[model samples]
Target: MGSTPRRSPRRRWASLLGATALAVTAGGALACPAGAAGTNVDFATHCIPPAVAGIPPIDGTTTANVSVDNTSPKVGDTVTVTYTVVTAAAGNPTDLALPADIMTPTGKVTLGGAQTGAVTVAGPKKNTPVPGKGAFPSFSMTGTFTVTSPGAITLSPGDYNIHTSYILELDTPCTVITPPAPVSETVTATSGTPTNTRSISLSSASGNPGDSVTVSGSDFTPGATVTLAGRSGDTQTADTATATVNAQGTFSGALTVNEPTTTGIVAYEGSAWNADLGAGPATYVVNDTTPVPDGSQKLTATVKAGTLSMSQAGDAVALSAVDFGQGGAATGALRTVTVKDFRGGPAGWSLTGKVTDFTGPGAKIGAGKLSWTPVCVTEAGSPSTCAAGSAGIVGVSGATLASTPDGTLTGGEFTVDAGLSLDVPAFTPPGSYSGVLTLTLT
Candidate 1:
């Protein structure tokens, strides 16, 4: 009796039909939609939540958490709001939007009630998902919302809602939200005092004649004029500041100490403005003189007349005159002279010469003059010519001369004559005579 295989055939068929119906209801009900149960499309509502459009969050921020004062701000009172946004999904939302409202919790939002501007977002976007668990995209945003109001408006401190939303087109379910990553930044302007530190130096402390000294300094104004104190005698101003100093703060100027003395030069930062930088002192020296002659004096003498007589019967007879010319003198004093006969030409005949001195006391002779003497001579022969004799015979000597001023006579004259014969000899060689002339101060 195994329970009589016990089922009726109809009973077995009914049981099979009920089980098939239950399976069909369970599978077909969930499969009826575009996506199967527990699939990505099944949670589409979660992935694409209702968009909360409002003011945008700050860049690089994961969420929008801004602090705004709901006080009734005056017309000029600037009320700023800081907003932050962060991505919670593996990729950035294609179209993210933000919106804000300032009103009581129960008041309806009005477009004209608030002042707004388009939000600016900056950063890289992720178009594709990561390989494994997909990357949790992150970003930050910072924005300042200025309040435009004429009077005070009250608002209690609370979690003020800032609508933030984004879109996700990927088949896999993904969430789009601006996490609360709020940040605040305050900017202010203030003024105090400027800093000024100046210094000056001279490259060289001293210099020679025509030498230049350089002066250098720092913190100098552009187009500044420089002046050296006592060194003005040698310092020269530069034509331009750029020529003197480069952008690196180096300056150079030359000071010529032409004078033979220690001079000081003071450099001023600017001519128009008085700013004494420093001073440089320098010295210079001078030296120079004239030329003089080597040889002290020169002397020259000339014989003007002379001739030999043969008719007188014995030897030669001649008469001649001498002249002393110009001389150079330093003391401006007169010089004396004396003469003698070396060869007696005849009886009662003598050789003589005269001296004329032009250099006087305290007198300067730029060009000197000449002096001459009268002439007398005698004959020296067998029948010598006598002064007063029938056989008038004579003997004579040539002239001898000397000057008082040693080595000072430049030129002079001498004379010779025959006492009893006129034997004028022709063709005599030109005679040049020299003597040592002494020079004295008297």
Candidate 2:
């Protein structure tokens, strides 16, 4: 049981207008004609050709129309390319294929149709059969094109004849189809204005430190690069942030102020597509951390002058016990007092010291037995020298002794070194004694 094999479709279909080697053996009978040259083989009842003749006689009208969704498009716009094809014939053609080619001024190819929400076309498309729709087969397809750059874009499109092998069948049940005409179209893109003009605004009219200030812009060039800058008080420019404009041509960002500086009015600026925007001098205030007085102004400050004072350098002065058996003088610890005058003004000040009698629990030692000399040491120059004084009796003249008649306070401060001596009597107290000396400033 052997079956009959058909000839090669490509080789047999190559000769559409003339006879080709496509023989059919049926019941001990050969179907091919006799001669190979100058004889046309009808494929309607013998063979299936791959394509039609290159320049076959036109038997019907075929038209192609092209259009776009947006005639005026800006950069980053997604436009649609619609192609409507019509063939005035009885029904769908036996073999039909349309290969379209498009050339753009800027040959940049955009691959992402899902991202731009447009229909993607990969290659040539075949004709679809629509029964009872019209007298002839009518088909249409739409492709997407994205405007990437700013400028005029030219689109040149044409359809290629790839189905040159398709031809009408002829013989026992012969049928013929008219060839479709070639079509092409060209377009030039133009510029269009944005939906709105470029404008910028601040989140708030005024704000304080630690608060976030939002800067927003709208109606800018779509997908354009933009940057934000600001200046506070007398400070220089500071770049805050950068963002890309969206499909709506809008962008916004927030900037936080954290430091305790630049208190005056603050202004912001921005630019996109060489256009400047966001000119605002917003008022801002940095409050002092210290609590202000009840009657003081919120923006006012006060500075107070210092005062002059005297203080003991160390703990109370300690004097050793002196036995009456020894008639020699008994010396006490060296005592020092400091006079600090922080006031910058030039003035005069007099220093004095008063002492009470040296007394124990029940015994007493007369203050006249103790005398001390005052030595003046000028630690800081007040533009004058401090006069030193001689020793004076404790109770009689030392009780309230003056520094010196000529000792004048100058440049505000000077130190005094006081030396104390106690003259014990023949039968002084048998217990420890203590006294208090008070230093005064005037």
Candidate 3:
């Protein structure tokens, strides 16, 4: 945001909230009375998204209201929290309205005190995506968190971001600008003892086959023999590991995972009977370690499609007429020819041109008398320039106008043009002569 940023309605006033607003106490920000089941906190947040595409840069403020279902939840209890936009981004009437379907908003809430982690909140899939200004959608997001430890659990409005498909590589940043004190609530809990839940964890989540994976468990009946069996898919392997639980209600030992059929998770678990006493299962990933030796096997495939061809810019071209006043030779340029090589590369291609004998009112001219100087040009995506054929009489044998090297060309388009010449016999009669020039591509 610039130093003199024009901010949103609710957000700009964050600095206005001072010690004169309320007596700073030990966090009693709830809309609920002094003692209530659930709690609510009111605050202001500001966001400034950089200019993206055609959307202008906008930094605005919005009021937020957050509430929780259980303020004094015991340890191990899951609590649901809801964060609502009390006031939409309708401030700053000058802001350009964004069209719909481009944005799907999602956000986060910061947690502190007893629990130290952020809660994920998902917003509506879409808002009013129509074109407008200063009227952002007012939405709410709900998330859950399991209470791990019991104490004064504090919740604060945190930063969030606007997600848009228009510029996926960039992110819109927001901030919690509640100036006075972060609007927060204090959670008073009853039990401090954490629940001893049956759970299993592995030291390494993934490894090659035969790698030793340490299986750890907690809260199992102390001193009981923990039988940790290894299973790949539905089949249990012969190798198994066991460890005696200490009086502290925990155990950890090594188990080797060696499944050869496929690359996937290999589960090492305690016996089902031990599951009744707080023993769970864990898994170790096996790498796809299958070796491919040289000269073992070869697979080949072929796609038979496409072609090599040429196209003329026009149907026909009329060369400049020459007067048979004691003639020797006459020359003109051929029409622009484009040759496309879509023949799946390799053996290269050839573009040849030839002409038929010209017939006039009194006599006929020999086809072998026509000659051409061909020039081949490289076009877009062409690997190399097509080689120009020699300048000589072409009607005697087809002229190799333009051709690529044996292993050089790999499917691209090239342009070609040729200078055509006619040798007029000195004693020939004066008349208008016409001939057909045919171009071929292979």
* Model 2: CA > 4 A from native: 1-304, 396-409
TM-score of each: 0.17, 0.29, 0.33
TM-score of 3: 0.33
- Write down the RMSD of all candidates, one decimal each: 60.7, 46.6, 31.0
1 or 3, which is superior by TM-score?
3
Scored by TM-score, the top model is 3
Candidate 3, RMSD to the unseen true structure: 31.0
TM-score of 2: 0.29
Cα lDDT for residue 143, candidate 1: 18
List, residue by residue over 1-442, the lDDT tens digit for candidate 2. Answer: 1222232111110000000111111122111111111111111111122233223233333343444434445544445444443332223233344222210100011122122111222112233333322233343433444444444443322221211111222111112222111212222344554333354544432233456656566656677666654444335344355666789977776656544442222222344223234322222222224445678743432222245455545444555556655534566533455555543222334455554566665766576666777777766545545555556765523443233221112344567776677666656646566554544444
Model 3, stretches more than 4 Å misplaced?
A: 1-46, 53-60, 88-102, 166-171, 177-181, 196-442
User: 1 or 2, which is superior by TM-score?
Assistant: 2
The lowest-lDDT stretch of 10 consecutive residues in candidate 2 is 13-22
> What is candidate 3's CA lDDT for residue 92?
22
The deviation in Å at residue 22 for candidate 2 is 99
